[model samples]
Target: MQSTLYPKCVLRGLATTTAIAAIAWATPGLAQESEDPPAAGDQVAANPNAIIVTARRRSETLQNTPVAITAIQPAALEAKGTLDIGDLQGTAPNLLITQQPTGSATANISIRGIAFADVEKSFDPAVGIYVDGVYIGTSTGQYLDFFDIESIEVLRGPQGTLFGRNTIAGVISIRRTKPTMEFGAKVETTVGSFGTWGMRGVLNVPIIEGELGVKFFEFHQQTDGYMRDGFTGQRLNSSNSENFGLAVRYNPSATFDATLTLERQDQTSKPYFASAMVPGDAFCGFVPPGACGGNLTDDLYTAYKVAEHSGFYKADGVTLDMEVGLGAVTVNSITSYRDSDESFYADFGTAGLFIAQRPQTYEQFSQELRFAGDLFGGFDYVAGLYYFESDYELDQSTFVFGAPAGGIGVIGHSESYAAFLDFNWEVFQDVRLSGGGRYTKDKKEYEFPLILSDSVKKSWSKFTPKLTIDWRPTPDMMLYGTWSRGYRSGGFSGRAGTPFSAQTPYDPETVDSFELGAKTEWLNGRGTFNVAGFYTDYKNIQQSTVITADNAQGNETIVVNAAGAKIKGVEADMSFEPLDGLNFSAAVGYTDSKFNGFIIGQPITRPDATIFLQQLDYSDVDPIFAPKWTLSLNGSYTIPVGEADVTLSAGYRYLAEYDQQIAPDPALYGALLAQDFSATPFVVPQNDPRVRSDAQNLLDASISAQVPMNDSGAMANFSLFVRNLLDDRGPSFAFAVAAYPNLWHYGVPREPRFWGASAGFEF
Candidate 1:
């Protein structure tokens, strides 16, 4: 374990070296032309054989572009056994997605410490998700299952260069496998311990003289619960899911093509309740052996129970894309409709007393249109217009003492329209200049429906602009600088906790960012490296405030922009093959984020006249959940045995400790920092200081043997695979308790090491 401890940046050199070696071994006898290595002073052209990416709204080779991006093709995903978007986090640098303790339905995506502060209907994710160029409006609908996908592109850093709002961190673009000229199908199934079972299949059917094609895919997964519930005599934290998708592609002619795709997913899981805290150190001496803290259910079980969850999500849309060769001009149009609904029970409790009866729901829709092409020698550009409208409604009904004492609900509609333009000038063959701007007008309206006297609604608007310059002095290197702006619209509040406080509305938040980056390919594309540094100034940061819900008229607390914050960081990514049959990739990111200026005080509007001695706030510190450093390394080797192949993969991930909450109140502050706050008697058990960061190593290996199945070139392969062979427990969470330091409890622990085997045939 003490082998050379190289940071992610240093590891880049190693990966590059390995890649160069691989290229030489791969093309030993290939003919080399005078321009085979690319002239030192010429601009690097894209690989003619590689699939072109439309990340910048144009089809271009990844190597030829100056943007910082990571592309995962379908073949690579299958080889790595990645089943969903979340699984790619470990494989990609500067990207992280972790379960929110709530459920897998909601995932927290972090990029360069920029993320969505809220995960509710009224708020949107900081990273934009696009499928076939259609923007996904809500995070709730972002949990898409993979099936016959062509590729996934992750663009790091702000994407205002081409993508619009909500792309503060970056963008995730999923390209689904389109209808092909020929027919093909693939089916897969796996079974393992804990009664785990999964089955998936895809089929392609060609009809009407190969002019029309249809493809469908279906996937189902189910598993027994890892934890047993004594009271209910049932499984605890069980997981199950069902997903299906169908797409029809029409190629009436070579110049025009249209596709209609529909998808549906159903997921259900049991909730894992939070563990209770133990007494202080003083009682550690007299307390019984089991009562001090080992297992939560050993001593006492609270009557409060968390409700289970079961939900269905459906997404359907039609995309019409037409490309006509009209000299140098290109025109494009896109329109989409998306809708989703989800309802679940949540456990909102303090101490051992559970607050059951909490239910929530949401609905939304959106549309957009754009066009681009080269007009004259002075500039080549794209201009577009967008329109988005969504409606959401949520209800928070709590049952205490077997009665609905606190009931809350809110309905809101948000709409926005914008026009933008981005253009580039070929200042010279080695240098190009680009600039873009957008003007947006947003409006929102909210209604209590059950409480407010006058309809509560408001409208706010803003304008954002961006500029970029790409300078390629050599075919092997590209350098660029950008200045861009990002914005998030205002939103409504949720139910209140206390009675004395009134509902609060938040205003829009905006950020102005400056960045410089470079991409380089050395050793004739055997290895590649990308690095970027950025600084962002944020204003009107939104934060959730817990308030009293005792008023008869109605008590509600909302998410509002309280103050400003700042973030700056450096990120690097590199990959290469050093030895024949050996490939390696690694990514590392360092972020420094914190509040710039802010003040906090007890609200004078509250009816209670109690004077607060002190309050917990992050006015001088960074927001919690922003890890200081993230490093990941993955390597694999393929060995050939006769006519068979065996591949072994090993990887490790290390993360620095950081706070989980934006700011703790008086009661939670001391426990989070592992300090002593005399006035605040309660401490958070899961936020204990001992559990700072998570470091773990994973080993996975697979062996496959291909045997002739028939006279045809087709063959059958049998394989065996194992994951998490060491079965490390990873890290635990810390929580607050009364009169003591934070308590530590592990997360929904991962599955232990499991082994399985499969046999399949391919032609």
Candidate 2:
């Protein structure tokens, strides 16, 4: 018993390094080549300490991963001033994250023309978020700060294999920096125009040698608004956000490691003001109070004010992981727990003449265990068991002529349990066969005693499977194909209408997807490209319907499922360092999504209330919000200046406009684009609304210099960043009301040319 652990620790370290060396010998080309003959001039190998990710759960170079993944390293993100998830848009193609016109704690994320589209409490996101191996369930949970991150991986396509629930579209994986047996700290601060100020810092401290370590990170950002609220006389789009986190790591023995993390984010903001949805022509004339007449336009903007929102998101979790090498097999044990809460108010004008407030909160806990290793016959596999439980509650307080709506509340709860297994076999020197499956049993309970008499509970079970074949014809090229299954659990509607609200439950959405992809690296690793094509068959799709209620008089509406849909798309990404000191990256995506065998004349909610003559025509056309073309381009150049380095980066993004309505009446195609800000009328097709495009290009650039500190391995850096350096307002307002046929703004009025200089030291 005389300290036998010391000898075992030393032996294990030697064994691990030795095994890694042996693997390198067999592959000879894995990750070590960059260590020696680094790539060409002014080019550096990707951070040597970077944790390689396959996205598909395999171990491969980020540049060589077969799937179409865009990884933004922490340093790269910091360089680009991306402090939160919403800023990830310009860096990736076919990806957009925008806060609702009224708040910050919640954001709408779209990828390849697929998105959640609704911010309702029961809504599930099309893009799944995974942080530190834990799947955060909702879109509201996706608005956290980008603190102390190692990398953010955006995998485009249905990731139904390893990541299950809500991954029918794609997966976003965030890996945070882990505690190390060292002491280090970095701090930065920036001040810019428009009363904007920001600061962030990260620190890692070793409490004991090989025994305990702790890492801490925090950030604070505040900015003034660009618009003024007419009613309150306050800045309309002001914001303030604060985030802090602590992580503690304990290494009890040579093979045991455990970590505990506590994190919180406080965000408060007032968002863009909006007006009521208006119709065209004399549509609202049929009603006594016609639409878009007299004070309607002025009163609509005044009446439709979304109250300021305050959000508090706290996450406290612990993970216990142990890795033991048992000759040819390695045993890995991971246990985790997480809890999250989100509360926000959504204001709808028609529901409340003044303002309506809807508050929602979600609580969740999750745990899972995995075992992975290599055995005989070139078989590598990982098997796991998973379970999750969550509770969601919605409280509605409506104000019509300044009063509450009976103080009603709706509550819902969900419980999910699953088991999954994934394995891969090296069928040949150049080929591998992989397969995985997940069986999930989910149960949900909904209770609206204040709105309904009886409670409702529904249970669903699904067996999702994935099959993939990967072939590496050459070490620099990988070709793969995958077929998988996807699912989205059903929930109750909170609307006050009939039939739909009477059912108490809806059907789950399911999809079957097939995909093929290829990744290739050429020009001596200076250039890499990825391409993928996918087709998905969706069933039991959910659509929001407006049903008139018997008791609520045209005000109460219910949401329901309409029919199925089909989606097909092709995506490509390329990164090329054509010459020394310059790097170019581009991403292009195309989506063809539409309804299949859907009937016409289905009644739905229209933005304009008074316009009555229009008929919805569902002919051959693309689905709403599904754009046919999306593209992004970025380039960076690094130049050596004396003893220091200078870097320059620029980026551009574009999206093709698509249709918002599917009216069957041919007359609607000639409807005018009578935005309130415009004096002229422009006619466009029903599906091509001419809204998503400004027909002009956007440009952003930055320049930075690095100055080294003394011999202590620290440094002071200076950087000046500018957005919209050309002073061209990107896209401003883009909608019109039937009552006010001539008022419109193209898009969000972006800030003008603003520049900031920052100086920081890292140790």
lDDT of each: 0.58, 0.60
Task: Write one digit per residue (lDDT tens) for candidate 2, span 649-737.
Answer: 77776656553323222234234212322222222233324233232244567788777777877877777787656665433322221
lDDT for 52 (candidate 2): 65
Best model number under lDDT: 2
What tens digits encode model 1's per-residue C-alpha lDDT throughout 1-763? 1112123213432343344335433443331211122111133344322335667776666665656677765554454444466566555556766544443356566677777634466676778888888777666656566656787888876675467777777888998777664476667776665677777777788875567888887888777755444345465556677777777776644433456667666777655543433443222333224324543222222212335534333334444433322224444545455545555554422222223333444433344445666778757788887766666666656554344655666666777778888877878887888888877777777666556755566777767787888898897788998888887777666453332122456778888888888987776676778888888887887665433223531223456565887888888878787777777777788888877554433221212323222333446544545677777776767888766666666656556665544333334433433432334333223333422334445555555455666675666656566666666443323222221122222233334465656555554
RMSD of 2: 9.4
Runs of candidate 2 with Cα error greater than 4 angstroms are 1-51, 101-104, 230-234, 252-254, 279-354, 401-408, 495-504, 545-559, 599-624, 658-697, 725-755
> Which portions of model 1 miss their true places by more than 4 Å?
1-51, 101-104, 230-234, 276-327, 346-352, 355-361, 496-503, 545-557, 601-616, 642-645, 663-726, 730-763
